[model samples]
Every structure is written in structure tokens, then in C-alpha cells.
Target: MSSSRTARWILAAVAAAGAYAPAWAAELPDRTPGLWETRALIDGRYRVVRRCFKQGERSAFIDAVGVGACSASAQKTIFGGWMMQADCRTPKALLSGKLLVSGDFGAELQGRVVTSVTPAAGGPVVKRTAMTFSSRRLGECATTPRG
Candidate 1:
């Protein structure tokens, strides 16, 4: 796949991992609001994405994951981690996957997602992605002047 396409898939997988958490467990363990750096590896290529979170943004983050396009099943909490299977429909494709996430939600987190993609008019292709992510308390977000 092209770099941009691959990056999109990686991001979708990451978002889906977070999106599948049960509503009752909406608050992530060890989670802190701040700047986070996430590194994702797909087929040996790596990319990094950064995000800044304000207070109570974690729920928003999870809610933003694929929004109405995705649904999760078979969710379970395991020792030191959580696991789920999800399916999502993108504008051009359908993605289904198994996701596993572990580690402290505060300082660091790691996840593995294995996905199978079916284009609107083609055969299915599978992809595996791994993500390692961490966050640091960046004090506070800079206030924006009201326009």
C-alpha cells in the first residue's frame, strides 16, 4: 500500500482499539490529560502522530473513533490488558479486526491490531499493525483568544 494509505489504516486501527472499550470503563486507567506521542509500525514502516488532550478529553477521543462507522464485539478485559474484535466501514472499504491493548494508560500503552480489508469492489487483504504510545503532562494547553 502507499504510505498515506498505510498511515490511514494504522490510525484507524489505533482509534478502533480505543473505541471498543465498554461504556462502563470509559475512564482509562492511569490516563493523564496532556501531550501524547504515538508510534505505529505497519509492515516494518513506522510513523508517529502527536495529540494534546485537555481535561475529560479521553472520552471524547474514544467517541471520535470511527464514530458511527464502527461496531465492536467480543470485548473482554484480560490480565494487564483488554481485547476486542471490531468492524468498521470507511468510505471506500470495510475493515474488520482483532485488537489487543496493554500497559498503563497513564504513562504508556501498547496495542496490536490485525485487520482484514475488503474494498467496495475487490478481494480482501490483511494487515497487521503494532502501536506503542505514551503521554506526558504538558502542564496545560495554551489558551486561545476568542475571535
Candidate 2:
């Protein structure tokens, strides 16, 4: 094929991908991080939680300590990287300031909620939520645009 023809083919492929971009963007996940801190509402006031984690890392010894379960969403740049927002709540909701991750299987933005205003002893255990952003090299959250 001629060079011009090859270039046209590449451009066409890119355009096709852009059309369904939003759905794909929403499906992607965030990267993992070494340490993270965020604000929270406690007794009608706000506080922060800072944590340390590693990929494929879990502790059975601390099962009694309690760990939170959370969820997240992501936004994609024209390039391959992403910005993700994770929520770990009683009702569960997204938060401000998204964590960024690479195109390589976003595992950074994860969350959980383990506490609740209501106790399980009354009936069932209600849980509180917490957001965990396992991310790219701490500061790799920022990236350049593809366009």
C-alpha cells in the first residue's frame, strides 16, 4: 500500500474509536498507590484517613481490625491514561479530585465501606464506606494529552 493510503487507514481507525469513547472511558479503572489520604464526615464533622497498601497484598492477621469495601469511576484523556474517582460509603458515592493511572489495567482506585450509623445487633450490620486509590508511582496521576 502507498504511504498516503496507510496514513488514511490509521486516521480512520482513530476516528472510529473516538465515537464510542465515553462508554469505554467510564468502564476503565484507576491505578494503585503507595499511600493515600482523604477527608471524611465524622459526627457531622470532617476528618482524614491515610493508608499504605501494595498490589496483591492482603492481611489475614488483621481481619479483626476491619477493612473497608469501596467502588470507583474513571475518566480518560485523549491519550491512554485515566483519572479515577473512588467512593467507600454507607450509601456509596464518588468523591472530588480523581486519582490517575496508566492504560495498564487500572488497579489504583479501589474503595470500601465497613462502618454504619446503625448497628447489625439491632437487625443487620450496616457498613461505612472508604475509598482507596492504589495508583501510579504516587505522582504519576498527571499526564499529557494525545491530541
- Candidate with best lDDT: 1
- Candidate 1 lDDT score relative to the true structure: 0.59
Query: Which ten contiguous residues of candidate 2 have the minimum total lDDT?
Result: 11-20
The TM-score values for the models, in the order shown, are 0.70, 0.28
Candidate maximizing TM-score: 1
- RMSD to the hidden true structure, all candidates: 3.7, 19.8
Any runs in candidate 2 off by more than 4 Å, and if so which? Answer: 1-31, 57-62, 65-147
| Tens digits of lDDT, candidate 1, 27-98 | 335356666666777656676766666554443433434567767666778877887676767667766767
* Clash numbers, per candidate: 1, 27
lDDT of 2: 0.31
